[model samples]
Target: MNYERQPYRRCGRSGLKLPAISLGLWFHFGQERTLHDQRAIIAKALELGITHLDLADRYGPPLGAAEEAFGTIYRKDLRGLRDEIVVSTKGGNPMWDGPYGAGNSRKHLLATLDRSLKRLGLDHVDIYYLHRDDQETPLEEQVATLDHIVRQGKALYVGVSNFTPERTAEAASLLRELGTPLTVHQPQYSLLRRRIEDGLLAVLEEHGVGCVVYSPLAQGLLTDRYLDGIPAGSRAAGGRFLTASDVKPEVVAFVRTLHDLAAERGQSVAQLALAWALRDPRVTSLLVGASSPEQLEGNVAAVDRLGFTDDELAFIDRTAKEAGVLA
Candidate 1:
């Protein structure tokens, strides 16, 4: 791996540095895909300096299948590169039928972390995140459990995902007291979804926590694929997180405008969206997932044109607002 080609950013106050774009295994890496296909994607990612692979217990058609798939690849191809890679997995999402199968309880967090490590065939993960907030559980209890995980050497750092600014502040303070400071915040952020800009970014900066954002392309909404209506086999056509209703006539028109803007910049709409996501200094990394090596290469190209003028930023903001996709 040519480390010099892949730029790394410091993760907030932590000494660790992550690639500008990290590969996410949240989708398209399950039983439906063969090991050979998964291997190619992973191999391409590492070759491109994307060493941070993000996973969660709740990912995959069947919960935990993604981890198992990655485990197979790790045992066969990535074991030797373990020290050079950053493997992050999250718990606190529903993985089973019972109450203990989900949420931020000590029992659930510890139990899921153990299962994840077993699935990945790893003694420890680089970072373990509490997937979401559990209002029913005490904040102290959740933070303490993460503290315990780090203390036990099961996870090197801790993070929170899908948490509000207020909860993030509380968790950071608690973790600081526990001597395992929060390393990062994983939120849904992109040009189309700018909710983090309201207050989340400020909170993270105040506490010196890095931001690793997901859905930086708004699940392909910011891409050119949706300009001609939801194509077959697209996420919107699948009616999962994205839907036909999401691609209203007006939204399609807005996407066309964004496409034109991207063309003016001599890049694809996807590349422009990714560059926009990384434009934030507070963002430590952008989590991107790909189904093919070609797609992965297209995404990595965004790094080549990350800079944007003040006028371009203002134009994006104005266009996003008119498109009604401003988070």
Candidate 2:
């Protein structure tokens, strides 16, 4: 936790400044881990100057466990330091089986935020986001409801995730008209996943909505732990999210080339990938998850040496194209 953090950037045109590397509690901060273990990671993150903590209502295996976990961390380690941290949580994802349990409807969005606030033991979160797009619900209703939440003092800022560029633009406009602009867009952007490159990046840039990309390592594919094959105690081998079949021979070979490139730069593949995503000034922060504090520290190390030479960029393009990651 002795790493030095570079300068932080503003989220869009907002006055809020976020750390270059933010910690996300989406995957690991759950009921499965002990409260002491969870608090330890938060403590480690704060000690390392990671000031942002991202959570959601449905982040737990049993639902709402992650926020409650945060409540425990807040009381134990973050009580007096709340003002120094930026807490973000999302709703609009199904947490219960009933009809009122999901979607971007005002009813669901408003009620869910109240519940999320209660769970986190906070009056209002720094930033609130829609977990996903609800095609069945009208876009205007969602945007208006989010703006209303800002007015009601439930959320300071609003954002959207997993939204298409067209829908993102529309939502931004709606929020803009109300004078409560959309602060950021949380998209799943990584070397392995280039879907965001298909106009989403431009849309956010044009609208002045900053991006906080998740899964920059593609759920561990870009890491050295998967180059030889799916090793024990890895995400792919867990048979839960990323699977062995997803790690084809071509993918492994591609990872090897990327790993070589990272070595040439005196960095890990994880570090290289994280640095690559942050190269865009439009990216406000890279939201990363870690099962252990060691992993968290290792991931943030990429922020130190992010200057890639022209030749390195060319090498990256060639290697990524061959792996079908740049196409």
Candidate 3:
């Protein structure tokens, strides 16, 4: 892998640097996809210098399938490159049947992490996250649990996902007192969803924490996947994650306008969306999923034209907001 192919940014104020574009095993890394195909996507990502891979215990449709798949692929194809790669995983999502199944209590978090380590066939992961805010668990307990994990050498850094600005600030404060600063915050950000711009971005900036955005393409809404109407096996067509109501008449019109803009810029719709998401320097990385090597390569090409003129940014924002994409 050529490191110069993609740029790297510092995560928060920490010493760790993640790729501008990190591969996420959040989708298409389950039992439904073949191992051969999954390996090919990963191989192409590495070739483009995407050294960070994000995983979670509950990513798969069957839960734990993603980590299990990565274990086999890592042991066979990526064993020698362990030091060069930054692996991340999350817990605190439901993975079993009973009350002991999930949430951010120390007992569950540590046990969940131990199971994750075992599945990844590693002693520890570079970064571990509390998957979501657990209202049932005390804030101090959640923050201290993350610190304890780092102290035990089970996770080098800690982070939180899908959290509100107030909760994130509180967790950051608690972690700071423990001497293990919060490293990153993963939030969904796209032209179709700009909630992070409301308050979370400022919070992370004030706390010196980095942001790694996911769903920058709005789960295919901003991509060419729906240009010809939803295909037979598309996510929207399957009524999972995305639904028919999401593909409204006005939304389609907006996407078509976006396509024209992308074509004028000599980039794919998905590429333009990725570039716009990374326009903010505070966004250290973008986590994307791909089902094929070609798709992954196209995403990496987004870095080729990261610049946007003042007019372009203003137009896109005004148009998106007018079309109700900002909601």
Stronger candidate by lDDT (1 vs 2): 1
Candidate 1 residue 172 C-alpha distance from true site, Å: 0.3
Error of 2 at 58 (Å): 0.5
**Model 3, range 1-327, lDDT digits (tens) per residue?**
879998999988889999999999978899999999989989998999999999999988679999999998999899999999999999998887788789998889988899999999999999999999999999999999999999999999999999999999999999999999999999999888889998999999999998999888888888988887888988899898999788887788788888999999999999999999999998999999998999999998999999999999998988887887677
Compute the lDDT for candidate 3.
0.92
Candidate 3, backbone clash total: 0
List where candidate 1 sits over 4 angstroms from the true fold: none
Candidate with best TM-score: 3
Q: What is the per-residue lDDT of model 2 for residues 1-327, given as tens digits with 9 covering 90 to 100?
A: 323554578888788888888999978888888887788788888877898899999988679999999987787778898888999999998877788989989989888888989989999999999999999999999999889999999888999999999999999999999999999999998877778888998998888898888888888888888777778988788877789998877778888988888898889999999999888888899999988889888988898888888998888778778877542
- Which parts of model 2 have CA positions greater than 4 angstroms off? 1-4
Instruction: Enumerate residue pairs that collide in model 2.
Output: none
| Models sorted by lDDT, best on top | 3, 1, 2
Better of 1 and 2 by TM-score: 1
Please give, for residues 49-120, the per-residue lDDT of candidate 1 as tens digits: 998999999888688889999999999999899999999999999888798988899999999999999999
lDDT of 1: 0.90
With candidate 1 superimposed using the best TM-score fit, by how many Å does residue 37's alpha carbon deviate from the native?
0.8
